[model samples]
Target: MSEFAIHSILLGSAFSTAFFGLFAVLNAVGQIIQRVMLLRTPTWKRVYQKKQLDTRPKDAVDQLPWETWRLVAGVIGVIALLFVLWGTDYVYGSIFGLGAAYVPSFVRRQMKDNARWRLRLEVRDFVAELRLALALNVTVSQALEHIADRSGQVTTSFIERVRYHVERTLRMESPEKMLEALAEDFQSEDLRKLLVLVRAALRGGMSLAEALAQSADSISQNIVASAELSIEEMPTKLILPMLFALFPTIMLLALIPAVSMLITSLSGVPGQP
Candidate 1:
């Protein structure tokens, strides 16, 4: 209705058109750069992540060396956006780009947690199988060969590698060394410690049953402690946003009108003064 309101609407419309125009140019430039990279054979292959001749998921997308290229392209996009708009607009673009970049990392973190849990469940059965082999007076190599034969069992590959490597150690006359190598290859803290214990037991002629039992117990306790610690710390870590951000905004929403009324009442009480 007023001149001020009319001018404000016009300014808003101008800003919207300018923003959309910049976005259109940015989108076109991004597509052009992508196509240019796709022209060269190596560059095209890097962006697309084509698999090798051997087995693996065709769409796994393991294009590693292209990471540098992606980073460069991202930097270029942000710089272009900032120049086209302003420094303030760069913040918006950065926040959006960062979220897109970290989507894969966040998904991988969750997947790793699930993978660890699956591995732990399988390890429980594995420990039981190993104990049974020990009870039957079967050598470690014999037990592992039996484990490797269990088709569709995910742990079979690891067991087969260890069994094959250990068998080679038997010919070389260094079983302890073989155990050490197994620990390194497996990349497992529990397995590495267990191997160290195995070496010590072999050297000192300690009871094998006692060593295996202790290792299993130790691993289970560590898992329990880890779970407990995570649970306890979660509330403390979670309070921050609620305390600093959400709580204040909510409180202001509830109190702002009442506070304004109180201020008006106090200001209007001037006749008594």
Candidate 2:
């Protein structure tokens, strides 16, 4: 083939491949957008917003500066790989750079998970403390303040937020309103349920101490049950990784000699040689 024709054919193939890849990426992104939009009901949106709040780190001072730096680093890395190293190196570098931008988000997600589990545990402790405080004849407001002081970081932050609203708008008749608001803010089913029962019992003139004590016991039981369930499932979770890693290695070791002998026999054939 002529040099011009060969170059033209290569260019056409490259353009076609690039175009198809771009189209696929766009199609995948569109599908994700559609799926997200489909679930954009008011209730789902509220739940999503609560999740966002829970996942966001309270200590985050500023994201803009770090995000800008990441953007610049990605651009520089892509340019260096594409211009200096060329070819597949550019593809790999671009992927790595793009993926690196999402590392912070992945880290945040893991942190959020850790924080959530810790919060659940801490909340159990808070409930226990509140139960004790109520038994000691402390008021609901006083119990909250005491727990805010005594609880771990995760639960303390949550209580402090509630304390802010409570202290700001102290009402003698309906102290449970502050707790109800706290439950709404927390978006935690356990916390919400406990608060709702407390509100109902207190409103009905039931013994606050006994109600709180019951709530504490139930929350403690739930926490223990959840932990036991996780322990039970641990072995099942390990099964897949053991199959993927160990099974392949064992099979490869068993087959290597047989495969090698077959290759040797084939190579020794006159036609094969």
Candidate 3:
């Protein structure tokens, strides 16, 4: 082989080795981190307890378990950033490996977004069930208990909690106070809005059940409108994927045989002897 060809081969081998080495190192680092976390249960518990004391909302405490991992990730990021500053050829790989640590949180956020949509639908159903029960002349506490029997798995515990508070309120405390607590526990905007309307109607001497029935109608209508809009927009959303993903594969498939035949014909047309 010529010097140029030899050098090209060596360079390609080096690049491949470096790429595979970096990937292996990243995977090893992740495994090491996981093992270390598993071994340090006491340390993790201490940090979790401290975080729980410091954080107000229960939801915010979810991040506490990842604190050690975040710290490890930050250290890795700093090292990668330093390596990048050294002007190495694999600087981009280092940066990417460093970013791998953040993948869990990003994935968690996406899952949470999907969960939020599902939870919103569940809340809508809960409200509609309440409306139906109220329409049948059931008292609020009894309505909550009735829904608890037939509600979705997602809202069953919430329904039971609400029913518990309602029963307690009837004996000693105010039902409004329990509703306020329930709203806080769920941290749902729709629940809060419904509570506000219900609270207002009760304070205004209007029928609480009737007001909730109207609110339920509004919620159902809004959900239907949203679904219709999403269906209407589906074709627009699919345009880019069809243009980029499906189009290229199809063109390649259509041209491959013709291109191969042309190449074969060109090779057959050798220099005339």
Candidate 4:
């Protein structure tokens, strides 16, 4: 019945109310997102199913759409922000929370970029191998089967998908149509060029081996040129990181001792506490 006890009870009640209110808001947002996802689920499923018929083992949790994961990340970020707000300055908490919210998306973007780079390298290898296979006078389908048997990790699934479609529609569709469709799906210029040459060969406009050899050489040269250019630009690319991250860190470290000494000196001055 004392003032301190009454203040504690009121504070506890406020904290509980705030926590529950935040939880309710987050729950409502999640439900809305879930409903939106559910409404779009059928379309997504249909598109994926139509594009890819092969069954691949995937974790149930991994199957959740990126939007759902982003939402979860955002909710976690908001909760973390609340904790930060309670424990630190509002400005720092806001900055930390905003950065945390975008972390998932940024990581996802980097992953996708890395995957694309790997796929580009894999496609170059695939083209070289296909060219070699063609030089042996094997049919395009046979060459694909040979490549699929030895494809790298990045392209194994993609090659298998292509092979599946090729075999499934062998009688009803030309390889050109299948390749064009795949090129559209992947949106790779290098792959599209290779497919275009292959299609030309399939249509009897050029010799298959000659066409593949040319495509392979062009792709190899491009890859080499890209590698050399990247090497040449490496130092330039590193300059920004040094300026933004390394320089500031070095400056901070160098200034810390000087700042501390100045502060100590000022504190030691007569009449200064």
Candidate 5:
């Protein structure tokens, strides 16, 4: 058999072994986590059962299991590994495979970060609008309904969710508790603080409009500061990529001719076969 064919077979076998090994490890870890959860929290089994029994329609993001992205990343990594192996050598292929495996998670994290930032801005606008609505001498619920009616798409879903929970448990639960629970779902500190201020206003602890205006101003300032900090740190964030990717390529390109000349000169200098 030709050497290239042997090399291809070896690469294929190694890829298959690595892929299955990774799968087995992930599966085992998931099983362990499930078992631990079930053991430590008896309600976990009930929660899992309830989720399985629930028949509500779900979005694409909700329908997929958490590990689905990892599987997709693995597939992409395998494809990248194969392509690199065919085009180059094992070292580059391995490096690229590992990097490819992390791309899905990195992209997902970046997307979530962007969505959270947008939500924070939307919450700021919502607080400002709520203050305006309250100044019109309406009840808190009426003002919320008015704002919900006019809210942009980003805040509409959140406001609608709050309205839904409030209406669903109008007699059984306090609106403040429902609002706080919904805010906690988003897991935004700014949103939580805004909700706390709104709750305090609802209980007549402070002036609603003034508290909301202050919260809006604070959120606006925070947003501006976050933007400025991101801008200031942009070069620092870029340094690692330049060092790992661009710098190496540039250095290799710059050194190749010199290394070739040194090899040629050394070859001519002595009988160093």
Candidate 6:
């Protein structure tokens, strides 16, 4: 009888300790996610310098979606972790499994996002290059080739790809048509709108340099407005989890000793004293 009671106590203690540790770790992870979700991630440049990176300009123009990948990886990770912890004390194996599945997709998403941001920054520069070449009596095709040679950074991008395609496919296509084709390959709405205005300038025989400057100024204003909106909302986002978790945690910490004493007293007077 005594042996049975001791074994039962041991089992209970082991499970309690395991559950307590798991809940604490999981809660910490939740807090991290909540905090990160609130961040604006000003740019994706930092996410670009990791593994599975293919910096091909063609690939940059068309990025793969990662939300579905997240769902698949999460399911697989949970299954794998459940298998590992079935009869083992290694409950933390779940953390390793989830991270293994998540990190690659996260890295890829960041790279694509960063690439989009760079595209935004370089839009004005691209227009300036085109306008300058036109001012110097260069043909549209010649200007594209020159931009490709001069402006490429760590990765060749939609700009370079469009330049190469125009040189090969349609030697007679206008500069506006080339930009429109480039916009088709890319998913940027701003670029598409700019391409339309550029095409209109060409059709109406307007000054190309003036049109480019106008479009560039419009994009700059949009970027500033977006930044201001993000800043205004940051305080409320930052407070949400703290109010929900940290405040309660502080109260629990303050009340813990009294709660413990009440529980002890309620256990029938501590051996009849």
Highest-TM-score candidate? 5
Mind giving the per-residue lDDT tens digits that candidate 1 earns over 1-273?
A: 223322332343344445444655677799899878666558656645643322221212334333443444445444444433442223333333433433444455556565555545555556557667777887666665565455234534345555555456644656456556655554567767677666667677577677778777877887788789878988987695345445334434544554455556768953333
lDDT of 3 by residue, 201-235 (tens): 77885688767877677777777887798789989
Tell me the tens digit of each residue's lDDT in model 4 across 201-250. 87889988878788878877887887798789889977954554453345
Question: Which residue pairs clash within candidate 1?
Answer: none
Q: What would the C-alpha RMSD of candidate 4 be, to one decimal place?
A: 10.4
> Where does candidate 5 stray beyond 4 Å?
1-24, 27-66, 75-95, 151-160, 169-172, 247-273
Q: How displaced is residue 161 in candidate 4, in Å?
A: 1.3
Q: Considering summed lDDT, which 10 consecutive residues are worst modelled in model 2?
A: 84-93
**By lDDT, is 1 or 6 better?**
6
Order of models, best lDDT first: 5, 4, 3, 6, 2, 1
How well does candidate 2 score on lDDT at residue 63?
38
Q: How accurate locally, in lDDT, is each candidate?
A: 0.53, 0.58, 0.60, 0.61, 0.64, 0.59
Clashing pairs in 5: none
Summed backbone clashes in each candidate are: 0, 0, 0, 0, 0, 0
| Global lDDT of model 3 | 0.60
Candidate 2 lDDT over 1-273, as tens digits, reads: 223332332343344335444555676699899778757757877788778676433523233344454444445444533432343213323433433433444556556666667767766777777777877787887877676556435534565665565555444435577666656666677788787678768788567776777777787788789889878998997795566446434544554554455556768953333
* lDDT score of residue 47 within candidate 5: 89
TM per prediction: 0.51, 0.52, 0.52, 0.59, 0.65, 0.54
- Which regions of candidate 6 fall more than 4 Å away from where they truly are? 1-57, 60-80, 83-88, 137-139, 152-155, 170-172, 229-273
Q: Which RMSD does model 3 reach against the true structure?
A: 11.1
* TM-score of model 6 (CA atoms): 0.54
